[model samples]
Target: MKVGFDGKRATQNITGLGNYSRYLIRLLTKFHPHNQFLIYAITIPPPELAISEVEYRYPGKQLIKSYWRSFGIIKNLLRDNIDLFHGLSNEIPYSLKTAGIPTVVTIHDLIFIRYPQYYSFIDRLIYKYKYRYAALHADKVIAISKQTKQDLMHYFGVNEDKIEVIYQDCDVIFHQQVTSLMKDEIKKKYQLPEKYLLNVGTIEERKNLMLIAKALLRIDNIHLVVVGRETKYTLTVKQFIKQNQLSERVHFLHNVAHCDLPAIYQHAELLIYPSRFEGFGIPIVEALHSGIPVIAAKGSCLEEAGGPGSIYIDPDDDVELAKQVKGIIDNNETKMKMVRMGKQYLDNFKSKLISDQTIHLYQNVIDNAKR
Candidate 1:
């Protein structure tokens, strides 16, 4: 089968959705080499990010790039005779149904709908239109978590049977054990504390980094290492840190290379993710695979991602969050138990299992279209 992908994020973004797209493409190709895969990207990715066997197709003469990705990619899909097209992100071309392409879209989350206060008015409108359209029109909708699946039905009125919940795995590099030497080198290079809690994700309102800051007030000597892109919300977090004089204990590392994240995870005491919501918590998955205990906010899909081994606290309760952190840190038995169970739970999200499930979905869509 000649499967095509919406590669805008894969080619342009280096984190989050981009990582998901790239990881899916690589997983599919590595496990099922018999099929051909093509990426329809608005721009060519850097050479280092290119996949081994997959071909990339870019718009030839379309000047309005975003327009091409939305409606103009139809001509190219027809010419390529794509058997299936997967939107690895939350949207697909608005014209794919007219083109009769069997389409699948992965809706990571309905965060904008759930937490409108976090997004601009324009962004919310655009997201609602595109995500609702894709969810309603695509042959299949892939929700990274069950929480996202219910959101699709609740917000978009999508049929339950048409949506499939498929969990995504992190980059395989997280599974590899970082050596003691590499850990020391990375620790020194990044000036990370000898012992620290790790928090990974963009510093935004929905991510709720301030909760971690508030919890820090209760913990005695524990330090936090935050690695993510900074937004205006970061200033809010920094303001709290300054007011509380927690600057000496909290470290923010921006522009940390993706290749170095595993060593960073390996050296941490645990990962604290106090996000208010997520479609699927990839960082929690990464922390689990990296063999670290995880503490995440309770009201969303994080429990599904963290599994039974990790601790979950209410996002608004910093006191409970601090207690859990102290519990895991003070007791080695508790820490090791969480780590062992996390690894066992991670078996359900192995690359081969997820790749196989996706392939089966693709085949089912194509077969139904033919009939």
Candidate 2:
């Protein structure tokens, strides 16, 4: 099979959608080397990711480059004779269907629609247009979680049959064991507390990080280690931390190298993700893969990502959140049980399994297109 991907995020982004794109490409290439893979992007991809098994293509002229991703890229797809083009993000080129190519798009989340206050009016309008168009027009839609699939059906009225729920795995590095020495070194380098609760993701309102900060007021000596890109919402989190006099207990680490994350996870007491919504919570899987217990918010697909053994609490209830944290921290037996169950739950999200399922989906889409 000759497969092409919308490699903008894979090549340009270092996290989130970019991670997803790279993971899919790397796994498919590793497990299915016989198939040809093409990565299409407007910019030149990072040198390390331009592997021999995959070919990279981009626009040459300025005019074509300006509209390449949405309109101009169709000619390139046709010229390359791509058997199938998968948009790793939420959009496929509007012209792909007209050009007779089967398209598959991965819709990570419909958070902007579900929680409109987190996004500006213009952003919501743009997302709704692009996401709706791609979901409606693509030959198949891949929702990262069942919650996202339901959102697609509700907001865009996409048929349930059109959407496939394929769970995403965290970075393969998380699955590897980190040495105690490495964990110690990372803790020292980052100035992380000896015992801390870990939270990973962008510090945004939608992430509900302030809930954790508020919960910290009730707990003693246990710090919260936050790792992710910071935004304007971070200012709000910081203000709350200062107002509550939690300056000594909250640590924020930004742009930490990807190689260092497993050690950070290994050293932490547990993972607390209070995000109000997610397509699928990769951090939950990352923490689980590290054999740490997890406490995530109740309202989204986090349960699917965190699995059955993980604890879920209301996003707004800091008291209950604090109780859960203290319980996990104080009770060794419960902590160990959660860790064991988390490891078992992570089996379903193995890279090989996800890659195989994706391959099967590709074949099904291709075969159906032929008829």
Deviation from native of the Cα of residue 254 in model 1, angstroms: 1.9
Clashing pairs in 1: none
- Model 1 TM-score on a 0 to 1 scale: 0.98
- Per-candidate clash tally: 0, 0
- What lDDT would each prediction earn against the true structure? 0.94, 0.91
Clashing pairs in 2: none
Query: Which RMSD values do the candidates have, in order?
Result: 0.9, 1.2
Candidate 2, residue 46: how far the Cα is off, in Å: 2.4
TM-score of each: 0.98, 0.97
The runs of at least 3 residues in candidate 1 whose Cα sits more than 4 Å from the true structure, single-residue gaps closed, are: none
Positional deviation of residue 242's Cα in model 2 after best superposition, in angstroms: 1.9
Which residues of candidate 2, in runs, are more than 4 Å off?
A: none
